[model samples]
Target: MDYTIEIATTDFITTESAVKGGADRIELCSAISEGGLTPSMGHIRKCREMFDLPIFPIIRPRSGDFLYTDEEFDLMMSDVKLCKELGCNGVVIGFLLNDGMIDKVRIETVVRAAYPMEVTFHRAFDRCKDPFIALEELIEAGCQRILTSGQQIKATDGLDLIKQLIEAAGDRIIIMPGSGLNPANIKYVAEATGAREFHGALRSSAESKMEFMLPSFAAIGDYINPAIKENDVREFKKALML
Candidate 1:
């Protein structure tokens, strides 16, 4: 199975380390603690200079709801275009219908904006009302890949369903299993589902980038909570080695 790491933050130094540690590709974003948001142009540009691996950016504008207004849709399109200009290999994005189906019109609009670059339908797939029905919409929309958790919390817990999706998708689109994937469980997920790709933050909660030294500082300083940790990747890979 192919191992993929997602660096959902603006830290270039840590992002580079992920590239060096045998990562096949990266999904770039920010604020993973809030389930990720679209990263800045400067962060994307910096990572582009640091790594030649495929850097597929997460095109989520905010973390809350997937249903977006026309204006929000416009913003997503603009960001998709920017990612293409910044040399991203592909983009990870998704939009859902009010009834929890794939929003075909919006899908076409973003896929069209991405143009020559690939589009990965992200975890929003798990939210769909029916996996089988959603599969048709994703394929019809010309999505290159779909990152799903087998409609569960992790691939291991949903391995049987994941296998079914993999078989059903066939060669039409990639079924990349994401969410709660770590080194220890990668082998089982790969074996059970025959999935070729995995996605994880590889986070180990390393010390905060900033610390609060004062007692009166009730605001609890340190704006960035997701400190970058290389060991998370290292240990993850090590577990996979077994």
Candidate 2:
């Protein structure tokens, strides 16, 4: 069976590593540590220029809650349009009502805006009051896929729900398992959840190469950076096949 590996990359370097390491697709975003924010237009354009694989940029304006004000939702809409204009394969987005239901109306608006490009509702599905309810709602909203960890912190811990969701979805929508997935656990996640598409950062730390460091200014740069290892991404894809 063929499985798809979508590597979540935060910057140019890690994106390059993921491509070199053989990611099937790219979930391009910024501030992944902040749970992923919409990447800058320049970043989007550059990635589109450099990579041949599918690129789906996240359309999040901020990090805190999934609830968005009208203004914030408008911002998200603009970002979605921009991604389309830049020739993205798709865009990942999510919004929730205060009552903890899928914001289907707003989500539908985004789906329309995205047009020919596909939409994958991001992990905000995990925060909804109900997963099954939200799953049906997302399908009704016209999303092609939902990237979730089965409402858990990690796919490994959420296998039961993930499996149940897969059964519930049953080809209606792609339930792509994500969050805390890596090369080490890829095989188990695939086996346990029966998920065809997986997502992860697959990153390891790399130290910055600056020879001179000022005592007080040393805090400016993260001397140790989180980066994708080409081999780890390769192994992650390999594990899915096993």
The best candidate in terms of lDDT: 2
Model 2: per-residue lDDT, tens digit, 27-74? 998999899999999999999999999999999999999999999998
Index of the highest-TM-score prediction: 2
lDDT, residue 214, candidate 1:
50
Clash number for each model: 0, 0
Total colliding residue pairs, candidate 1: 0
Off by over 4 Å in 1: 1-10, 208-212, 216-225, 238-242
Instruction: Estimate the lDDT of model 1.
Output: 0.79
Tens digits of per-residue lDDT for model 1, 186-217: 76777788887778777644445455545455
Off by over 4 Å in 2: 217-221
Name the Cα RMSD for model 2: 1.3
In candidate 1, the residue pairs with backbone N, CA or C atoms under 3 Å apart (3 or more residues apart, or in different chains) clash, namely: none
> lDDT score of model 2?
0.91
